[model samples]
Target chain A: MEDNVKKIMHVMRRAPHGSIYTYEGLEMILIMAAYEQDLSIAFIGDGVYALKKNQDTEGISMKGFAKTFMALDGYDVEKLYVDRVSLEERGLTEDDLLVDVELLDSVEIGRRMTEQDVVIHH
Target chain B: MSHRFLATILNSDKVKIGILLKEGPYNHQAADTAYKFAEAAIKKGHTVDAVFLYNDGVINATNLTDPPQDDRNIADRWSKMAKEHGVEILACIAASKRRGITDDIMIDGGSITGLGTLTDIAIRNDRLLTFGD
Candidate 1:
């Protein structure tokens, strides 16, 4: 039963709603979580905006999926990480994020990335 | 137990590869790159299991895509690859609907599938490579 488990990482580098990459990436993560692979997500660059607080997409005519980040824990996707520089560069902090994530430097994040068998970057 | 490199280390010579394409044809080189990568992998004695299209990538499966006389027909290339190599070229149904791509316009050997199918491809294939932005 344990033979097929894979270490898959989803890397988010795009801003939310600007393009469909990050949004659709979230959808894929939600589904893969059910399969119980060793899944983790690293938010980098403008991808940190995806975890920001109080994102309302009413004007954009798109569904507010920022809240969806909070629901990922329910799907058993608890291993979430954020690039420290990316969050700080955007003038955001842990408090600005909608979810709890480990804020690590890109160096550390890259090390962990090397450990993943499949790394899907969005 | 799972190893660091799952398929390459455990499965001997031939690796089962699954591709996830996120961009469309003509506009970007993503579809072309994926096709070339799959072809190269197959030529090297690997099994190209599937090509799953998402977002704008679903446009690659549409038969309505007709290039000019001098240009390469990307959609036809995917069709031929699917037919000859037995690779499953699938587009996400939700994305296809948003892009006005219907089953009637789907290219030969291409089909519409759900995200669950993508999950299955990720699990079963030895290597799952994602292309595009």
Candidate 2:
């Protein structure tokens, strides 16, 4: 008999994506990893900015928390997904992002969310 | 022990829902939306075990919310509903203290807890829905 695996999904769908929300989402992912929980991230709407490259926080005097997205891969956080429609709406491409991500369509994203044992929306 | 195990198995069909409220009842629309969702979830036969109030949401737990004559007193309404339903309404201790929310009011099932409690709900619950702007 096989063991029941618990899968968790984090859905990011905020606009004007500020530091606090970004930090909270990343912290959740890290904490899940530390506990050996299965975790995945899905970026929707303006939430994609958290993974964008060349984020110049110098003007805002904000801490460089965007760099944490790059460190996600090192934390065994490989399931980074971006909504394809949202990416195109924002005029962004794979090259515009700091981390490599799997672009998913609406149907595929819904299917994935429904398949998870736990789903967290931020 | 077997009966308890059977009950657990039967309840497994129901989803464990944790609602994270980050905003206060100052906005009537947001409060109305949350209440409607909670009502709808009950109507749909899904169990809502807990509601974790964080950040500005600590304001909702305060006993001093007084809205205008024209607008609905959402905070009071939430408190009443929560009391009647026996719902677990946990206000984050760190957030509540920072926002000057003291333990004066008698909000049934609502208490000031820590972030660790929220993390426990996140891990144990089947769905952690966050309500933020």
lDDT for B23 (candidate 2): 74
- Docking class of predicted structure 2: acceptable
Provide i-RMS per model in Å.
1.3, 3.4
lDDT of 2 by residue, B48-89 (tens): 777788767777887777677897776666676677765678
Q: What are the per-residue Cα lDDT tens digits for candidate 2 across A1-122? A: 12333577887776424636666556656766655557799999888877788878788776677778788888888898999999999999999998889999989988998877777666
For candidate 2 chain B, which ten residues in a row score worst on lDDT? B26-35
Question: Model 1 segments beyond 4 Å from truth?
Answer: B1-11
**What is the C-alpha local distance difference test score of candidate 1?**
0.90
**Per-candidate interface DockQ score:** 0.56, 0.26
lDDT of each: 0.90, 0.74
C-alpha positional error of residue B126 in candidate 2 after TM-score superposition, expressed in Å: 4.6
TM-score of each: 0.92, 0.74
C-alpha displacement of A121 in model 2, angstroms? 2.8
Chain A TM-score compared with the true chain A, each model in order? 0.96, 0.89
User: Where is model 2 more than 4 Å wrong at Cα?
Assistant: A1-5, A15-20, B1-16, B39-46, B68-72, B78-84, B93-109, B126-133
Chain B TM-score of candidate number 1: 0.90
